[model samples]
Target: MNDKENRSRSRNETSTRTGMGASRPSRRIVAGHTRPCAECGLVDWKLDDSRGEVSCNSCGLVVEENVIDPGAEWTNHANTGVDRSRVGAPITHTLADKGLNTSIAASDLTSGGASRNGISARSRREWRRRRVIDERSKTRQSKIRNRVKAFQYIRDRSQLPSSLKEEACRIYGMLSDEGFVTGRSIAGVTAACTYLVARKEGIPRQIPDLAEKFHVGEKELSRLIRGVSRRFNMHTITLPPQFFPKFVSDLELPPETMMALDGLWNTIEPHTDIWQGKKPMGVAAALIYKAAAEGGTRRTQSDICKVANVSEVTLRGLIKQIDGLLKSIGSPSA
Candidate 1:
C-alpha cells in the first residue's frame, strides 16, 4: 500500500489498543517510514489525508510528507538525516517563541546575509553568470575577427613569396571549400606571410614598411617575424653602431710611434793586427749631452751615443762633424 494508507492503519491499531479516539501512531509502528522526535516517542500525531502531512498534535509539530532530502543519499546521517521531513508552521512557531516576526523568509532577518559572510549565494550566482556570458561574447567576437583577417591575407597571394603565396592559395582553397568568400583582406595576408618567410630565411625586413603595405600593425608584424625566425633557427646580429668604427681603427697602425728604437747596442771592438790593439772606448757623457743641446733636435747626445754604440768622447767628436754636415745640407742635426 502507499505510505498514507499504511500510516492510517497503524494509527487505528494504536487508538484501539489504548481505547482513545486520538489517531497518534507510536515510533515503533513507523520505524522506517516516519521521522523520529527527540523529546518523546511519537508523543502525538496527526496524518492529513488531504494535505498528506504527519504532524504532532501534542507539540504542534507539522511535517510535510513526500519531501526528498539531500542527506538520505549518504549511508549514515546523525540526527539530521535526509529522510526527515521539512515541516511547515514549526518555523513560524520557532520564530514566534523567540519573539520574532514569523512572516518574513528565514534569510532576511539573518544579518541581511552580510554579517554571516562577504556576499549572499544569490548575488554570487548572478555575478558568475554575467561574467561567463561576457567572456563567451568576447571570445566569439575575437575569433570571428581573426578568421576574417586570416581570410583576407590568403586572397592576395601574388605579392608574397613562392612558399607564402602557395600557402595563401591553399588557405583560399580551404576557405572556398568552407563556403566563406568575404571574410578578411587578401593584401594583408600576403604581406604577413611574405615577412614571416623572409625572417625564416635570415632576411631582415622592417615591420613598419610591411604594415604600411599590408595595413597591419608594426608590433603585430614584429611578433610574427620573431616567431618565424625562432622556428627556422635563424639569428640576426645586433651589434652596436659604434662597434664597427672601433674594429676598423684597431686594424690600423699607430702613426705617431710607427718606427721606435727597440734594440740595445754594445761596443765590442777587438784587437786587430792592422789596427791599434784593443782599448776600452770611453768618452765624456757631458760632451754628448752638450752636443744634443746645440743640435736643437729635442734629443740628448746620450741618445745619440746609445744609437751609435760609442763612448761619450767619440760621440762628441762625431756630433761636431755631423752638426757641420747637417748645416751644409741646410738642415738641423736630428
Candidate 2:
C-alpha cells in the first residue's frame, strides 16, 4: 500500500510540470485575455504590423484588426538618413477661428505676381472681389463677428504675455458659449478673465489695471470675476509671495532682497489676524519697500506705489502692519 501511494504522488508531480519539466504553464496572456483558436488548440499567434492585424499562426484565424499605429512621424524632407521632423504651431484659442483659416494672399493679387500667373485684368478684378467676400464670410455670422472683435480687444488691451492672453481668451470663449456673456459687456468679461488667470498663474495684476486698460467699470469687473469663478468651480487665492517676483523684477531689486522678503512673509503668515484681512497687493508693496531698504538697495515708497498701483496712504498702512508684526515676533524689521 505504501509503494502504491508513493507512485501516485510521483505521477501527480509530473502532471503539474509542463512537457519540458518547466514550471510555467503553456497558456499566455493576449490582449489582457486568454483566447484559444477554435480550429487550433495552440496559442501561437503572429502580429502583422503593416496590416494592423493579429492572427493565430497555427489556424490563420484573425484575433484582432484595425489596431492604431502608435509611432512618431518623421518629415524626411531632405530624404536623408536623419529622422528630422517639424510640426505646425498648436491651435490657439486667442483667435476667433482658432487660427486655422487660410487667407488669400494679397501679394498674389498684385500686378507683377498676377501677370506671372497669366491672369488677365478682368480675372484679377473678379479674384480681388472674391477675396474680399471670402474674408468677410469668415466673420459674417454674429457669433464669429463678436468673437473677432472681443479677441482683438483682449490681445490689444490686456498687456499680458502671449500665454496669459491665450488663457484669458480661452476662458472668455467658454463663458460666451455658456451664455454668461449675454447682456454683459465684452470688455468687462475680458478684464475679469485676465485678472483671474493672472492671479491663478501666480503673477497677479490688480483689477484696477486690467479695468483701466480694457475700459471696464471696476465694480462690474469684480462682479464678473466672482460669477465666472463660481461658474467654473475654480478657487483663486492670491498670496503676497505670488506678487513678489513681478514687483521685484519691475523695480530691479537685488536677488538678496528676495530671501529677506520671503523671511518676512513666513513670519507673518502664521499670525492670522495680522494678514487675514489685508489686501495682497498692499502687503506685497510694503514688503518690497522694506526688503529693499534692509538689503541696502533702497526704493522709495513712491516708486513701489507706482509699480504696485497702490496709493501712498494705503501703502503706509500696510507698512505699519508689517512693522508691528515683526516687532511682536522679535524679528528684525526690514
Candidate 3:
C-alpha cells in the first residue's frame, strides 16, 4: 500500500478502537448518577427510598432495583408501635421555651426508671436541685416568664382550639417585639389575638365573647385587635353569610328554618349594599327572624334579637329591607 493510504487506515483503526467512530452512542459513567431505562429508553427516573429502586416515570419500569439507601435508619412515623423517631417533639410557639426545653419529671424514679431511693441521698438531692434549676432557668428572663404567664392565662380562659392558640401566641410574639405589649395588659393582647385568629379562621367567635371570657373590657380588646392588625398589616375580610347556617344550628333552630335562612342569605349576598356597613351578627339575626316568620316557625323577634345581641329596632329595620328586596325580586319573603 501507499504511505498515505497506510496512515489513513491506521488512523481509522485507532478511531474504531477508541470508540470515537462507533455507530452507537457511548454511555458515560458518573458517580451517583442515573441513566435511561433499558426497557422504555426513558431518562426520567425516580429514586424510591422505601423500596430502594430506581423506576421509570413514564412506563413504571424498574430500572435498577434494590439499591442500598444511605439515609437515616429511623423514621418520624411508623405503622407499628410508637414512632421510634430519635427526634424530639416538633417545635411549637405556644410554649414560652418554643417547646425545645427538656422537662424533668417529678417522679420518685430517675429518668431511666431506676429507683431514686436505691441511689445515694446525695444523688437524689442533686437531681432535685437540677430539676429546680431547670424550672428556674425558664423564668430567669422576664420576657419568657411573661410569655409563660400570658400563655397560661389564654389556656385557662379561652376555649380556642390548639391551632388557634398557637396562632394567638405567634401574634402576641409579634406584638411584643413591636413594643405593643409594653403597657397593654397581656390578657388583653392574648384575648385580642385569639379573637383575630378565630375570626380569620372563620370560626364563630365575637369580640365581646372573647372579652367576657378573658375578663377584659370590650374597648380594650378592640384597641389591641386594631393595633395588632395595623402593625401586622393584616386585613381580614368579613365572615361570609354562609357561616350563619352553622351558627343558627347551635340555637336549636329547625332544619327548615335554617334552609330558609340559607336561601335568604344567598339571595342577598350579591346585593351587598343592603347589609353593607352593618354589623353582620345583627343582619344575620334579622334574617333568621324573617326566615322563621316566613317558614311558619314560632321564634319571636325578641328571642332572636337577644340571641344575636342586637336591638329589636335594628332587627326590624333589617327585616323590612330584606322583605322589600324579596318583593322587588318577585320572590316570597324568606
Candidate 4:
C-alpha cells in the first residue's frame, strides 16, 4: 500500500475508535450473562477490566483476583456464600411466566437507591439486623415505663382517713427508686396501696374482692396488709358477742372487783330465801353494799324499799347483813 494511503487509513481507524468525549472510555456494555460465585452465592457478575477482580454484589466478596474462566465448581466451595465474582451474570431481572420478578433485588422497591441492586442489597441486610436490636431496646424501655406509671396510678388512687396521699407518694418513691425496676405491676401496687389506706383509716375491705380487683393472690395481699400495719403501728382487734369481759379486762380492774360485780347480784338472789316480807331485794342489796364500801349513796334504803315493794324492816335487815359480810370479808374497799 502507498504511504499516503496507509496514513489516511490509520487516521480513519483512530477517529472511528475515539468516543464523543476525547479520550474517555465508552459506557460499560453488559453481556447479559450470569454465573453463581463459588465463594459467595451471588448469581450476578459485572466485569471490571482494570483490576482483574470479580466482585459479587450480593455478599461483596472478591471471587477472582487474577484468574480467567474462574473454574467450574467455583460455586461449590466453603466460600460460595461469600464470593464477590463479577462475571457472566444477567444484568437485569426478568419476570417468569407468572409475571412476577421474584428477584433478589426486592430491597430496591423499599429503598430507591442509585445503584438500585447493589445498595439496596447491602442496606436491607444491615437495616434488618439493626431493626431487630432496636425493637428489643424499645420493648425493654416500654416495660420499664409502664411499671413506673402503674405505681403512680396507685399512689393517686389511694384513699386513707389521714394524710394517706402523702404516705402513698412516699411509698411509691421508695419502691420506684430503691426497689427493683420492674419488680411490681400496676394491679399489685394498687392492691397494696388500697389495703394500706384502709388499714390506716380503720376501714375494713373484703380481702377476696381486693385481691381480685388488684390481680393479686390472697397470700400476697395478706403480706402487704401486714407490712402496712407494721409500718403504721396500728392495732387491730375483733370484738366477740360477749364483749363485756374484754372491756372489763382492758380496764385493768382488780380480779376480785370483777368477780364481785359479776356474782354480787346472783348471791343476793339465793339469800332471798331467808328474807321475809316483800323486799326490794335487788336494789336494796346493790345500794347498801355500794354505800358502805364506796362511802357514798345516791339512794337510801327507804327509797329502795319503796321501789322494790319491800317493807323497811326487811330492807334494813338485808342491808345490815350485807354490811356485816363485807366487813368480815375484809374487802379492799372496806
Model 2 lDDT, full chain set: 0.81
Candidate 1, residue 87: lDDT: 41
- Candidate 3 lDDT over residue span 1-334, tens digit each: 4755754554454335345548533333323546654654434567777677777665677756778766675764656876755466778878887888888877753544435357566777787888898899879977878899888877777788888888888888877777788888988989888877877787757777788888899898889889888877765766436357654775667888877877888898889888888888888887877777777775787777667777899888888898888888887663
- Best candidate (score: lDDT): 2
Cα-based TM-score, every candidate: 0.20, 0.70, 0.69, 0.25
In what order do the candidates fall by TM-score, top score first?
A: 2, 3, 4, 1
Question: What is the C-alpha lDDT profile of model 1 across 1-334, one tens digit per residue?
Answer: 5666755555566445455734444443232335544323344556655466666654556655853333423333355655334442222211112123223233532445534657676765665566566545643654344544554454343255545545544443444345443454444444555665544444424455568767777766566555434544445543112122221123231322111111000110121221123111212222233332443423454564443235567655644643444465454323
The Cα RMSD in angstroms, rounded to one decimal, for candidate 3 relative to the true structure is: 9.6
Model 2, 30-145: lDDT tens digits are 56336655545445567777788878765588878986656675576686796544454458999998978878888989989899999899989999999999989897778788
For candidate 1, the 10 contiguous residues with the lowest summed lDDT are 260-269
Q: Which consecutive 10 residues in model 4 have the weakest lDDT in total?
A: 92-101
Write down the worst ten-residue block by lDDT for model 2: 24-33
lDDT, candidate 3, equals 0.74
Stretches > 4 Å off in candidate 2: 1-70, 74-90, 106-125, 159-164
Quote model 1's TM-score.
0.20
Give lDDT: candidate 1, residue 308.
Answer: 29
Q: What is the per-residue lDDT of model 4 for residues 136-226, given as tens digits with 9 covering 90 to 100?
A: 5643655445544554455444434335644554554444445532455556655665666554454434456567665678887777666
